[model samples]
Target: MATQTYDVFQVIADPSRRQMLQLLSEDSLTINALASSFDMSRPAVSKHVKILHSAGFISIQDIGRERYCILNHDGFAEVQEWIDYFDAFWKSKLKKLEALLNEKTGSHKL
Candidate 1:
């Protein structure tokens, strides 16, 4: 079977998946452990985990018999980059507005 691809944003769009990421953020946990925190069935939880894994938000490691899920930075990096671009964009706009306001108000101090 071909490997499934997921968009990082789409994968994180689901509330369940977002919660899973939040839980994993605290520390690594087994699939079962992650599932226990949610009201969904184990299989349902596993499905979200699979999406998270495929989207690069998490890494699953086999420790003996249990599979542990750990948070990964790869997926978040894309989100952060996007946010940073907008952040700079907004800052530039605000600076221009500030300069205009200062010019109108005769206030040279920035």
Candidate 2:
């Protein structure tokens, strides 16, 4: 069997990974610093970081002896674009509904 790969949504489904993103959004942190914030072992934290790295949500930098994790906007662009499409769809639907309601009530206030 082939090893399955996860997409951004699937990778971020884990609570730990979500929290890691939130932290990185505030400021870049070294691997050790990120590991300290979680109850899990350093290796476990590293795994989550790896997923985020692979998904393009975060970038790793080697600073001296430490590896720092920083937030990257490229991954979120996909999610944002998906949401924006639905936002426009809903806005159009709501406007049509409002027009229908106004026509029925014979009121232009709306």
Candidate 3:
């Protein structure tokens, strides 16, 4: 049998990896550039990058001897799709809360 490959959930399991993605979402940065802002060492950041790379969350580009980390955000669709399943529940809860608040403050008239 062959091993199947998929790591959408594993990539987000680490807090550090999650933070790295959050930072990369705003803009692409070189490994050194990304590492400079954090208190952790470069090797540690590199390890996180390796994991992200394996998970297909980010890509690297070579530019004048420097490698830049680009956020490969296509993978996020799955995450959003998963979360949207609970949206209706949360929306209903918020609506109920709004109605209750309006009843108390006379602000819910609509």
Clashes per candidate (backbone, < 3 Å): 0, 0, 0
The 0-to-1 C-alpha lDDT of every candidate, in the order given, reads 0.89, 0.89, 0.84
Q: Which 10 successive residues of model 3 have the least lDDT summed? A: 1-10
Tens-digit lDDT track of model 2 for 51-103: 88888899999988988999988887977888999999999999999999979
Superposed Cα deviation of residue 107, candidate 2 (Å): 36
Which candidate would rank higher by TM-score, 2 or 3?
A: 2
Task: Name model 2 segments beyond 4 Å from true.
Answer: 1-4, 79-110
In the range 68-100, model 3's lDDT, one tens digit per residue, is 999997666687877897797799999999988
How would you encode candidate 1's per-residue C-alpha lDDT over 1-110 as one tens digit per residue?
A: 44677887788788999898998999999999999999999988988888899888999999999999999988768778889999999999999999999897896554
True lDDT of residue 17, candidate 3: 85
- TM-score for each of the candidates: 0.65, 0.66, 0.61
Count residue pairs with overlapping backbones in model 1: 0
Query: What's the best-to-worst order under TM-score?
Result: 2, 1, 3
